[model samples]
Target: MKIFEIVFSPTGGTEKVSGYIADALEGEPVAVDLTDCGLGFRTVAMTKEDVAVIAVPSYGGRVPAVAVERLGMVRGNGARAVLVCAYGNRAYEDTLVELEDAAKGAGFRVIAAVSAIAEHSVVRQFAADRPDAQDAVQLAGFARKIQQKISEGDASEPAIPGNRPYKKAGGTGMVPKATKECTDCGACATACPVGAIDKDDPRRVDKKACISCMRCVAVCPHAARAVNPIMLSAATKMLSKACVDRKECELFI
Candidate 1:
């Protein structure tokens, strides 16, 4: 059976956690990027014999709306799935349950689940440099357990955390703005998962379209894009208490 690594990582943190797990699990996996809005996920069909690692970052204790939309279009065809929710050291809350529901609705069997820690996509200081060496070891260990389950032909669904009627999704207002150094390079626009940046100008950002994922700021080669410092500082201070401690990875199977 083939392995699928379906991921929605706009700022690379979620991808890193997912990669660590996939690396420890069987063979090389076929990659499926949910962040690419241009991809037609409806055509991504898999056989019942296949296994899939569906990973998405927890955005405000919930899954990104766009990731859910794209994942809905894909045909899982009864493939066994490992659900992973990578969070920024805070609680994932309803993220994994929501993701499990979405994956089941798309025809996947929920065989395993993981709650992992990663660096925050927006507030850089909170959980910074996460999915680090320690995280890698934890995730690899989780993957091995999942492999053992698969080897035993156990398809039991794990008890994932979160409530049904998930908590409301509050929007993050930390939109990044381009600085004077911007050369209209369009790199941010091209790399933006939501197409929130204007390709022609690269300076104009569609705030409504932006998911506050900080992808533009990370992608800007000239370091010309950034959120308001005051806003970032306030957010950092607000979340400091919750993110101060080092969190550990959790696996359910």
Candidate 2:
């Protein structure tokens, strides 16, 4: 059976966690990058013998809109799927349940689910240096259990916890701006999934178009992009209590 690693990671955090799980599973999986603006996800098709590892980052306690949209286009064709939700330490809330629904709607048979921690995409301090050594070990253990379940011919659906009407997604109020160090390389413009950054002038950012996924910030080699200091301080203060503690990985099979 073939394995497909389908993921929507604007930054590298979710991708890193997915790599660990896919590697532990038993195949050289084909990668389907959901974050690529150029990809035509509707053309991705699979068979019953195939297994898929679907991963996405939790944005503000919910799945990103772009991810949900792209994932819906994939035709699972009765493929067995393992759902993964990677988030900053604060919470994943309804991400897993929502993902399960999306996968099932796309014709995938839900077999297993996982929730793991990764560094925050927008707020950097939360879950910093995560999917570390400890996370890697736990993720591998989860994969082994999943392998066992499949080997034993288990077809039961995992009971994932979350509310039916998912929490409303908030606005992308914060946008990363270019500093004096910006070289106008156009990398950020090319990499932006939404075309928020102006190609002719990299310094120009369209706030309404930007999802605040931080792809530009992460990809910048110059280390010149950042949000307003006042906004960042307030966000850091708000999330400090919830993110400071260590949150462990969870698995459902």
Candidate 3:
């Protein structure tokens, strides 16, 4: 069956996590970058003969709003899906379950679910250098299990982790402000999935539009953007366990 790896990664962590799973499956992956032009609006049309590994990072215990909006545009046509929610060692909370719902809504039949840990996109200390060697081995094994399940024609939706009511995780709502070094080169604006950054002056981020995925901070050539220091510190402190040096990936069949 044709395999597709659809991902929404701004800081490369989610992409790395998704890649490990895709590699193990030994299926030809169709890569769709959510950050790419018009991807947010265009539909990902697939057929029953295909399999999809849909992966995205958890932004504030939820799917990135832009990704949520964009994923809704896809049409899976009963294609079996393996949903993955990559997080920064912090709790995935509602991410995986919500992702399942979104993928199902997009016409995919949920077959498997995964929650992988990667380096924190916002809090630097957590899951640093993750999806590393240990994670790779585990993910490779996970892939084998999934391959077996698919071969057995087991397409039943598996029990995925997350809260039914979706535990309340407060939104950091940290607006990334551009620093003086910003050249107004417009890279951030162009890269933003929601057009949160102003193209004319990239420094000014429309907080209302920003999803706080930190794409602008990571992609900035000048390292010109930053979130609130106090809030970041508090968050890091609260999520220390999630930041502990845990092996990056785990496999479940």
Check candidate 2 and list the clashing pairs: none
Question: 43 in model 1: Cα distance from truth in Å?
Answer: 1.0
Q: Show how many residue pairs clash in every candidate, following the order shown.
A: 0, 0, 0
Which digits, one per residue and each the tens of the lDDT, describe model 1 over residues 1-253?
8889999998899888888877777755799999887898989998888899999999989999999999999999999999989999988999999999999999999999999988898787778898888878778888899999988889999999899899999965789999988889899999888999998888888989999988888888899999899998998898899999988998898
The lDDT of model 3 is: 0.81
All models: lDDT?
0.90, 0.90, 0.81
Candidate order by decreasing TM-score = 1, 2, 3
lDDT of 1 at 232: 89
Q: How well does candidate 2 score on lDDT at residue 124? A: 84
Runs of candidate 3 with Cα error greater than 4 angstroms are 245-252
lDDT of 3 by residue, 1-253 (tens): 6788889998999888888777777556688887775554455688987888889998778887667677788888999888888888867779988888889888899888788888888887788888788887877778788888888888877887677776665554777888888888888888887788888888777887777888888998999889889989987888886567564454434
What is the Cα-based lDDT of residue 88 in candidate 3?
86
Each candidate structure's TM-score, on Cα atoms with residue i matched to residue i, is: 0.97, 0.97, 0.91
Per-residue lDDT of 237 in model 1: 90
